[model samples]
Target: MRWNRIKRRNVLETGYDCLNGIPLISLRYAIIVAEVLNFHHAANVLGTTQSSVSTRIKGLENALGVLLFERRHRGVRLTEIGRHFVAEVSASIAQIDHAVRTAGAAIDGMEGHLSIGLHSPITAGFLADLRRQYRASYPMIKQSVLESRSSETIALVRGGQLDLAFVVGTVNASDCHSRLLWREPIVAALPLDHPLAKREAITWLDLAGETFLVQHGGTGPQVFERVIRRISERERVPRVHRCDVARDTLMGLVAAGDGITLTTETTTHVPFPGVVFRLIADESESARFSAVWSPHNRNPALLNMLDLATQMSGAASFMETSNT
Candidate 1:
């Protein structure tokens, strides 16, 4: 990140007699001083002598006509005004870093950083493999993976906040490109002691009287609720227990005999004891995974991540077919 000090000062110099023998200096010097908060460290980072940094900072305060930092016995601390100035300056620095990286990528015929917005299920599976391989091949390109709900992720991609996203369900943003990754069928997870655990497959009606555990995230609970309503036609939907807050937590809860939960086949390798996964007998329900990217951002790093996702999906499909 690059730190930018305000180019134009807001200080109005009303009197030439206001100087109390303090010297003047640049905003760049003030920025370096604010960042390190220590005269020595700031001097080291700026490749200057500590005494020089101190002298320059004193000069900056003289010019600004306000104390930016409170000089402590050891190091320093920002005054309230200094804190606000630092916040804005730090953000500007980040933007400057991005601008520099973008320019460098252009010269080198590549793209800079790639930020991926992913839903919980996609983050757990397809994206995991993609991240590993993509980083290995393109170590120079930085990657950011954010996990959020499908709706929110889609909105981010549409607004240009995210470079790309892996989402569940359909992505309707016209400003971005989306590719189908896989279709996952929902399944029921039952405790080993449950009678339905022994069945080859269980239908929605089999859960009519059972206590259902709903995994909360994305639209998993909503989709499952719709499935339950269709099969169990009650005036009030069953108050299903919500046990797990995250994907892994939900799996742990399912294995602990909390209650039966619904999930996809892609999720496996549960560690807890006495848990059995049963395929849903019904075929009417399914969820689709997709890769969404902004059409405007031609970032090669983002495109490379998408390529990795495509490769992972292909490998998964081949594995499925071979197993079948």
Candidate 2:
């Protein structure tokens, strides 16, 4: 029996039957065959001979001890197991490609200092992988994070002091160019013992008698403002309470039964002893997160970061990069 080795993104593949068995080509061939349903057509798509595809597939089936496809006169039909297997293999290929891009970009890229500002740790959690990938791709480019209020982060971007900022809501600045990355539903944080915590979803009116806590100078105020605007009749709006402390402290208040607060889905990751995060019944209470930067700021590393972000986000801004 002949053997082969394929290396991609640190994932090593050896021969059809080795210490670590399974060939990359076998998985690729299986997916193509499942998609085309004809060995000859799949071979054309894979840029290989029909017999070669057949041989690899037979080896794959033998290794797995199951028939992936039923042979037919003109074509083939995938087994129930084959359909699920192909879907998983396709996802694996996507991750491999991401790893390749992350590795390749870090190698041949510009080196510079980058200052990033963020309002919440949730934003950091979402970009954690991207940041690691960026660091790997631009090892020499020093990067640091400055956790501050959204207002300050926006100002820093306007002043060109910060290269990138992940902010909540839309940014209104002539010098700053912003792109919406995602919209997450603003959920209400209530004490585990609170009456409303028992409900699956809470409404605006449900909060009429509740004390609404807003994080002073942070994105929490803007989210609250929108919640107020969403209410048509303001006959009895909840009295807003301002918290000058940090997010964790404010959540501590909720847990202490001092008051209830509203925040984004990212806060769910934050575990407080007595706080429960519940989704808002109204979809209009969604919070928008955006990436903001000064157009005039000329940083090669920042440009590279934006390109990767654009590709990852799949936003219309991606078109702008293509044009440039």
Candidate 3:
């Protein structure tokens, strides 16, 4: 069974010759004849001879075993059955046309779906804005954002569970590639009434002996690790408490004067009522965000997203250089 044929050549085989050697053009001819109600006029509109159009319509009528036209003195007119046939065929042709367009767009990366993973909670700034811009530009493409821990995000990307991911720092995976997207300065998240909350900036030592609350995973724990790493190897480390709860819960504990926590400047965008974020005096303790993805992924939409990120990064660099 042949699906497509041109010049006596079978281009594709679908194991079903449903059309029975009939050209799809015959359907178009039938539709035009029904619209014009005149054989000569329909031929003129189709850029074919009148006899050709009439023959095509006759073939279609014979195939369907129905009388499609009722001859009249003025011109040809559609029979009651022909009108219903035309309506159904017209709807089917429109659907076929839409499917063709959608397939073409998918090949060009302008359509389809993408799943992206997020590790850090940068839901309010550049990352969020970038995703919004992507949606605005390609509304046909469906997107989902999966929130998870840093290591889990990287693992998902590497395992092909996610098309892309935005995670903290850099991920070291042979099967995955990562590029830094942006950075945020580490800030001390303290209770509004804490002593350091009044200062413009505070050092890591300022947090010493302060109940240091940490998230089990994510920005809060990353900050805790860095603070402890910065302390001298011989010096006794300050006591730290762990909070297996969410970031917002940890912030609430800080506000309750239960403990203090640290996060990047992005946390300020999140509305934590009793939490005040202050810059860390040591700038080296800043946080870096990166995008990680499986290098083997063949999704064209993923490629388009990566291209967009590159362009935006370049534009940001240019603006920063100009400002200086």
Task: Indicate which candidate wins on TM-score.
Answer: 3
Sort the candidates on lDDT, descending order: 2, 3, 1
lDDT of 3 by residue, 1-324 (tens): 111211122211222333567567777667777778898887887778989987877877888999989867767988889888888877766666567767889999899999999865646767877788888877888998888777787788878999999877766666677776677787878998988888988776676667678777766566667757765432657667877787777888989999887787766888888889888776574577777888788898998887787676653442211111
RMSD (Cα, Å) for all candidates, in order, is 13.5, 16.4, 6.3
Whose TM-score is higher: candidate 2's or candidate 3's?
A: 3
Which residue pairs clash in candidate 1?
2-93
Residue-level lDDT of model 1, residues 1-324, one tens digit each, is 233323232221111222244322344556777767898888786677989878877776666677888999889899988777657755754565567666777555355677888755433455566677777887777778788877777788878888887767655555667777766777777777888888988876777666677656675656566656754563335647765476666656666777777766666444446677888777576767777777777766776676667776773452211111
* Candidate 2, RMSD to the unseen true structure: 16.4
lDDT of 2: 0.76
Q: Per-residue lDDT for 1-324 in model 2, tens only?
A: 001111342342333433247786687678778878999998897678999999989998998888899999999999988877777777766776766765555554555578999877643445665677788877888998999988898888888889899888777676678777666678889999998899999887787677777777777768567656655354675477887988888989999988888888877877878999998786564677778888787777888887777666666542321112
Q: Better model by TM-score, 1 or 2?
A: 2
TM-score of every model?
0.52, 0.60, 0.85
When 1 and 2 are scored with lDDT, the better candidate is 2
Worst 10 residues of 3 by lDDT: 1-10
Query: Model 2 Cα displacement at 79 (Å)?
Result: 76
